[model samples]
Target: MEAAPPAPPRPWPAALAIGALAQTLFSWRVTIPHQLVFDEVHYVPAARALRALTAPANSEHPLIGKLLIAVGIQLFGDHPLGWRALSTVAGTAVVMGVFAILWLGTRQLRPAVVGALLTILNFTVFVQARIAMLDGFMAAFVVLGVAAMLWSMRAHGAAMWRRWIGAAVLLGLAVACKWTAAPYVAAAAGAFLVLRHRRADRWPGMNPAFAIGVLAGVSIATYFVTFAPAFFYAAEPLTWAQLVPFQLDMYRLQTQILPPHTYQSSWSTWPLDLRPIWYLYEPADGAQRGILMIGNPVVLWGGLIAVCACAIGWVRTRDTASGASAMLWLFSIAIWAAIPKSLGFFYYFYLSSIWLPIALAIAFDRFGRRLRYGDEAFVLLSAVLFVHFYPILAATALPGPQAFTRWTWFDSWR
Candidate 1:
């Protein structure tokens, strides 16, 4: 009974193929623009400071994301590639992570590929990953946590507990990148209990109290450990006594109200694609370069309807994989509506963006079976739309000004 999980037919071969392809897309001319884009202004410098043992620049966010950026700069030298190399890696990891979630949860190959490909060709992951930002690292680790959590409960093995602990540690790593990872920790813990509960106490480590405690304790401890480097900083070296107070300071900064910006958006508008952030739109290197953080219309907008279908399928069939996908998308976005953070942006939906493909794939696989490979056709449609908007998404050379309007179907996107 405990071995019901399909451990056979390893998903890695297909998942690795997807990762390799995604790597190529993520790294192609990733060093363009010859300078930082968007919030790279904040983080690249922060990374450099941390590398030099100076004061952390963006102290409001956690240190691991910047630490990775520091590692990239250390390996590649402080340039565009240095600033963005790890982001590309993290971004590619995200696409691969999405594939793993779908494949592991559903044990379906084609649907996994379709979902991952659609996510890769979208606007948010590509743009955010190519730039020096925390979302890429945050999103990547969240996926890793979800994948590990899924594997821990379902697969029967001596090391199941290790995988579960790894999931919590990864969640800590995600929050160490940004506070946005907090919700995912809860989601992962919740998922662990739910999956194990369905199987009763047949397994050896099915103790609910211990499971929750391990998740909570391990993740909190890991989050605290990430601040170790701060204690050694040459400038304003932090002591253990200051750690809790420092975290409180960061919390205050995160929730503080700030003057509104042109692109600031509410949580409700995210699914509607009403607000798009143009991270970079300036003439550079003899051509106009524009990189907009917007969702793929065919994938992002269509995904909402598909998510609803996934919810219905979950309730009727108790499809854990499909249900998990729906919950991830919902919890990721809905938390913003309830969070104390007053200011939000289109890119804040990056986590939700990650789950859309999984939800879409599950829905298409379940509901579109009647249409015969309808999921493939939907993926193809997403690819075509991706091609149509490649220039805007990839910071490519545009024909001229107002060319952005060609893809701006809605006035709000402008």
Candidate 2:
């Protein structure tokens, strides 16, 4: 019999412990001021409604996220801190989860570390984790679902069945978190189908039957869990309206507009980093006072190059992990911008931020081959810039001129 492929080596606990340190350092600057920065206004009310079991207006997103927020409120009291507690937790989870994904994908510890560290340094992930909004939770579910799917692919026999079921459940939970997750699910399933077709007749029928069952069960449970109270009422029972209001609320939120906001940016500029939304600004109170939110210029700029690298890698070698990751990253960023919605903003690209780290990891993988001085210099330069600007990007207060200079690309940001 052919020798079984050696199992992927697990990183030492010390490396994982370092990842925890990174998570704490990056996330600690979060939760300061304890005020709702942006979308918290909408989600906070929905969380409160969830606590009271009342159907609130504009609660169109999935309930699991709101329910998570409610749990935070239960722990922290129904204030800004309470509403925001879950966001921090979810953000941290995404950090760890993404690390696990990168580790699993390439089966390389170094790449996984790079991915996690880059994710922590990114402006979008940092700010979103600190705020009370659905994006952080949505990101957590997306990455988690993707990780489960990856694990499912590597499993076999009875183990394979279990992994498939897990993947479906996670994907279903992802959809139940945000309708935006639909594209990711489709991408994953599509990727799976393509891979299965390529490997047909090599093994037992690679039907995703167990996965489908788990997906259906989890989707229904996740949906109804939010409206169990509504179902309790004898007169109303379960109605399509209950399940859909959350979606409609999200739909309306995307398309509807109120008074023009100060920092709204067109979607077109997100990829170019031409416009970025400012989440918070306060006078410097010594070291702790400075805080502004934006995507990491390193990840933002280098990520574009990484995209090109990822495309080239896929074209040359047809590596699904590299190609799919790059495709998802670009899709996550551009697809939303392409939507004909009126109220789009730079922050809508927050979840898209996850891919920057993946892109960088791919770039690093390429670097290992040639190791040219220029490539090494480029990597070092990007790392320095990421570290240098991280404080400001994560809302670290500096003198006024210092802060404004970072706002180099100003058109869409204003």
Q: Please tell me which predicted candidate would have the highest lDDT against the true structure.
A: 1
Clashing pairs for predicted structure model 2, backbone only: 60-246, 290-396, 290-397, 291-395, 291-397, 292-395
Stretches of candidate 2 above 4 Å error? 1-8, 12-15, 26-29, 55-57, 200-205, 208-221, 229-253, 257-260, 282-291, 372-383, 394-414
What are the per-residue Cα lDDT tens digits for candidate 2 across 1-414? 899998766775735675567557645655555566556777777777777765553445666777778889999898766877678777777777778777767888767777777777676777777777777787888888777777766776777667666666666666666767767766776667666766653224555654555556665566556555444334434466656564565787756656676766677667677767666565543443434556777778778888888888888988866787788787786667566566667777777878878877767775445664543455466567667766656556566644556555564543
lDDT of each: 0.86, 0.68
As for candidate 1, its clashing pairs are none
lDDT of 1 by residue, 276-381 (tens): 9999899977889898899988888889988999899889998776687788899888889889877889999988887888888889888878988788788888
How many collisions per candidate?
0, 6
TM-score of each prediction: 0.96, 0.83
202 Cα displacement, candidate 2 (Å)? 9.4
How high is the lDDT of residue 84 in model 1? 93
Model 1 TM-score relative to the real fold: 0.96
